[model samples]
Target chain A: MRNLFNYIAKYHFFFLFVFLQVISIMLVIQNHHYHRSLFINSSNFLAGNLYDMRNNVVQYFALKSINEQLAQENQALMEKFPESFMKTDQQIFEFRDTLHQKQFRYINAKIINNSVRNRNNYLTINKGSMHGVQPDMGVITTEGVIGIVQNVSRNFSTVMSFLHSETQISAKIKKNNHLGTITWQGYDYQKATMLYIPPHLELARGDTIITSGFSHIFPEGIPIGTIDEFEVKRGDYFFTIEVDLFIDFNQIEYVNIVKNVFRDELTELEQSQ
Target chain B: MEFTALKYFGRFIVIIFIQIMILNHIYFGGYITPYIYPLFILMMPFSIKGWVLLVVAFFSGLTMDMFSNTPGMHSSATVLIAFLRPAVINFISTKKEFETSTEPSFSVMGKTGVFFYVLILIFVHHFSMFLLETFRLDEIGAVFMRSLFSTIASVVVIMLAFLFSGRTKKVRI
Candidate 1:
């Protein structure tokens, strides 16, 4: 025991370094998924409260833009007012729209924290489990999709942004329905890479891409981006394409957390397979 | 002795406050965040034990990570730099024996010594942080560019901090 003590005393610094380094690396590995490590993230109580305080001060600066967005939405809603209907249904036809099933419900939230520069970027929203937010719920702005909910605490949550390297969002070309995946190249926030697109399709510079809805996270027909550039991948059948995202993540303030009502049902049905 | 301890504690709080509240917001083209919190680590008294220093570094980095929403990236980098600091100091110092309760600063080490000290530590910290943040073999060039820019920015911030503290301004040769 004395010999062991002597050895440790002799190499105390080295041991300390190794010990700390291991802990740090363990933290990094544990936080890689982030979904299960909610408390370690900024969404935790103390961090979340600090950010909330900061956001309270910062939110005022973005008031003009937020007001504009709200005003625009209000104007759109006002246009759909019952008084605006050309024909007042004297014979009130019992009309429940059969076209939409209300599978996706949205919970409004504000982003308290955001990052776009890193390889794996994430955003923290004020809403969490208490606000009906859960992991795998889709987060979106008025413009387009922002990201998917990664970790959720009681009053806060972290979203793995679409800009992350691991997030290969399933998207398809709007014109011919050419299936492709959208991924960030960790460079330009406005630009992203579109993969699995066949070279056979005649690609245009401004081709629209929307979510395929195959992942059950986002609904179909949600506009993701427009093709900014494209090129044939050498020796491969796929095209190396670049897209300009409709949603600017840096300026995103308000978001809607989408809860798919039938997600569990769908998952259960798939699990049986 | 109590006053000095309280002063250091206050400095720790102030530094952490500025880092989270102000410095974290200064996102230089989204690639660099000027991190000067390591200045606290660098300014520790020479008599501080290895384990204590490591603990301080961990907490300092963990604080930054908490605010920045980056879990372990900063902590790992800071701890690595803290671990390397003793060796670097030993290698650079002309005198083998060190005085007790002496904090590292421009006043203690003079201009050249302090410059090299800050340069090496800041560069290593930034490089490790960027590498860990990216964690991709393909973006080696990106990592280098980011680290370089961030190191330059952080070094400037650290120098400003030193000057602002009246650590170097009054002792100008």
Candidate 2:
């Protein structure tokens, strides 16, 4: 017993570190499934508001530059020469319009506190529970889905940005109902991967991907991105496709937090089983 | 001691404000969020007990977490860093070698020693943080990439802050 005590006392710090890590892992596992660990999420509205205030000043300056960039892009987009003889370009233009404008609503909220450099990126918004922002609500900018609200306080909410590894949403081929899960690989904010897409489905470069509406997190038809590239799995039936996200999340200023009015009803009905 | 405690508290609040306010807003492709605030922990007096260091680090990170809305993430990471600090310091600098009563700084550890010291701690802190944040090995490659890139950025920021922090002007306690 004395020998054991001596060994433990000598390496107590190592033991403590391991013990703490186990606790952290346990907490993480407990919180993995959404809608259960509401108490500790970033969506606590008051904290969200406070964090937003801290970030507001810096983002304010960034917004000016973003606005300038948008103006330039908007100008270039408007000046595209109308080619008279190509059906592909015409079809592309029409598809782009509907995909960009349809399916999502923009809710303008200032980021009070946000982190992008971390492995798990989250954004805090000035809007909160009072503003109809609720847990699991989808957050998007003019570009694409930024994140989902993980926690909500009365006056502020926290958004789990698509940059987070934990972020995964159901998306499908716009041309067909071929479904896959879009997830952040955590390396780049602008890039995401579409997993479990069947190889049998015809996919092409620049094919549009959109939300399937199977999950209440996002409404159907929200444009996620265009297929940047794709590769067939060596021994599998699906394609691991790279998606060029529509929204440049790093440059996003304003975002809309979507609250499905019938979310509770739908969840209750589904859980009735 | 009481007066010094208040001063440190004030410093803590200021660093967090700067971290969340000015630094967070400057998102360069979201690849960098300046985390110089951790320097506050690095700069604390080395003479302080391990438990005190742990608690202070936890509180400082908790405050930032509260403001950032990431519950327990920052606190947990900071605690780990704090816990490892004593071991690192003992390994890097002997009690006799550290002549100054002031905390770890470039002037104290020299540029090269300071770099390695901060690099080790920042690497540990970022590794734990990213692992906790991701909580999955599914995208381990990407998570590692982000961890490396973000660690480099955070190190740059933390180093600059420490180098610029200079000697604390003696305030009468």
Candidate 3:
């Protein structure tokens, strides 16, 4: 018994190191799946409280610019409201019996912490479950779609930003209906690639790309970005297109979280089929 | 004995706070973020047990990981570096030469020896970290480039740490 204790004590530190690393690995692997993310998630009460304190410091510096941007966006929205009303009126008259109206709502929230320095940057926001924020909800700035919420607690949430390599958004050419999957290639932050664009698709430099809204997470017709460049390889079946995002995420402070009111019903119906 | 232990513990907390809170925020356009926490490992007493070194390295890295939101990347890299440290120290300095428990540093190992020692450990840490982050060989070239850049940044910080801390008498265990 004494010898066994001596042997165990001799390697205690090594065993401790191994044990901690094993637990850390388990946490990482658990994070890879959606269903098992209950405990390993960063959206706990303590982290939320800490980030709330830290965000207070960062928010003070960002308030001035945020106010200016909000004012400008407000002005733009007011100006566009009349035209949007006119368009709706025209559509209503044209298809009064058949057309269904979709209501879009936006929730304002502040980004407390963000990192664009990493290849896969995740942004943390001050809004969470208490504020009605949920995982897979779409987050967008006045400029464009920033990302989707990945994890949420009572008072905080983490956004897997567009800069993340694992991020893929459905986008289509504004001029034509050519659709493609936009993904980051771990290169420059400003540039992202659109995959599976058929070689024959006529794409122009500076053509706008808007969200396809195939996923119920984001509503259809949200602006994504503009095509920066395009090329078709000889004998290849697809066009390699590059995009420049509309929003400058580095300076993004305030965003609007979008929620689909009927998402639960739709999800259940889809799953049942 | 309590006083000395408290002093070491205090220094460890201060080092970790500065490393995670302040230095991690100093990314220069995503190209450079120098990690200087390894200085704690490099400064540990030479006569410390092998297992103790590994445990210290693990906690030191876990502290960094907690702040960075990287689960085990830093911890794993640090443990690997700590495991290799004793072997590197032995290869560079003989037991007869390092007759005391003084930690590995520039003054103890001299200019050239310490440089090689720090270089080897920093390379090991950065290489392991970058490979794990990439998670595939398809982008090996990009991963290698990032590792090299990170290593250069870390080595510069480690050297500056050595320059500031004055030489101490070898403490024989």
Candidate 4:
């Protein structure tokens, strides 16, 4: 017993180092998965507040660009206003047209902290559970799709950005509707790779890629990116196509949280099958 | 003793602020992010106990992870570098002895000594961090590239920091 104690005392530092490394590695593995909830992320109270404070100061510098984006979006929205359309039909139609039911709702949120340099990037938004934000909700901008909400606090949430290595979105080429999965290669912030695209299909440069509505998270036809370059290796069945993403992650300051009203029903029905 | 502890605490806060707030935002070339946070562990007093050093490194890394949303990647890398710091110092400091409680700096270890010290430690920290972040063998090349670029960037920043501080020390003298 004395020998064992002496041995432990002698090599205690090594043991402590190993112990800390094990704990850290375990944390890394645990947080790597999409479903696991972590308490120490930036969305936590203290970090969230700190980021919020920083954003308050830094947001001023970005006001001009934000205004420009908002003006552009406003112009687009103005074109969709009811007054912009002239009613040419002589037949009066009933106001209650039940053809389209609401499938998604948008909640506006300001991003307080965002990182694109990391292999697994996450963005912290100011809106959280109190604002009806929840895990797995899709986040998007007026320009393009952003990410999925992973963790939520009272007034803050962390979004797994599309730039993340593990993030895969169901997307399709707009022209032919050929479906593929979009994934980041951890190299470029402005680009992603589209996989599962067979080499036999005709592809062109600048072909638009949009979200396929197959996943309950995002609505169909949201702009993802455009095809940049593609090549098929000999004997390989899939085309290695690079996409130029529409969203410039560095300049993103505001995002909209997408709440799918029928998500629970859709998921339950799929699971039952 | 209390004053020294307070000074170290202040430095901890300042270094972390610079790391997450300032340096984290500077994403040079979209791939390289210079991490000078490990300089805190590198600058620890020579006589710091092993267990204390390890504990300090773990917390320092954990703090960075909290802000960056990487829970364990920084901690694991920092702990490994902290564990190897003593051996690295001994390997480099042949025929010379550092006074107890003296922190490693440009004035204390000279320019080349500090440069090599920062280079090796920062490279190890960044390589381990990138490896753990990716957690795959297939992309080892990307991990190595990232580590190499980031280490070079971090070494330059840390050396500049040392030079500026050394100048201030001269002024104090």
Please tell me which predicted candidate would have the highest TM-score against the true structure.
4
* Best-to-worst DockQ order: 4, 1, 2, 3
Q: Is candidate 2 or candidate 4 better by lDDT?
A: 4
Off by over 4 Å in 3: A1-26, A34-42, A45-47, A80-104, B95-101, B167-173
What's the CA error at residue A272 for candidate 2, in Å? 3.1
- TM-score-wise, the better of 3 and 4 is 4
What proportion of the real contacts between chains A and B does each prediction keep? Answer: 0.66, 0.29, 0.21, 0.77
Ranking by TM-score: 4, 1, 3, 2
Interface RMSD values, listed in order for every candidate: 1.6, 3.4, 3.2, 1.1
For A1-273, candidate 3 gives per-residue lDDT tens digits of 999999889878667667766765665555444334453334566555666677787678878897998799888888866556655434534434323644455678888777776766777788888888888899987567888898887788888888876788898888887878989887577778887888777778899888888777787778778888888878778988888888777788888999877788788999999
Candidate 3 C-alpha lDDT tens digits along B23-118 = 766775475677888778877878877787788788777666655556676778888888888789888876456756576666678888888899
Please give the range of 10 consecutive residues that has the lowest summed lDDT in model 1 chain A: A89-98
Task: Write candidate 1's Cα lDDT for A15-78 as tens digits.
Answer: 9888888887777777766455545678889889888999999999999998988899999999
> How far is A153's C-alpha from truth in model 3 (Å)?
2.1
- What tens-digit string does per-residue lDDT give for candidate 1 at B1-173? 79977987898999998888888778786678898899999888888888889988988898887766677888999999899998888877877567877877666777777778889999999889888777777898988988899889999889877766654546664
lDDT of 2 by residue, A144-230 (tens): 777888777777777777887677899999998888999886657778999998777778999999988788878878899999989
lDDT of model 2 at position A230: 95
User: How high is each candidate's TM-score?
Assistant: 0.93, 0.77, 0.85, 0.95
What stretches of model 4 exceed 4 Å from their correct place? A91-100
Give per-residue CA lDDT, model 4, range A1-273, as digits (tens).
999999989999999999999999998998888776468788899999999998999999999999998899899999887777787877445685535887889999999998888888889999999999999999998668899999999999999998887888999999999999998998678999999999889999999999998998998899988999999868888998999998999999889999999999999999999
Model 4 chain A: ten consecutive residues of lowest lDDT: A90-99
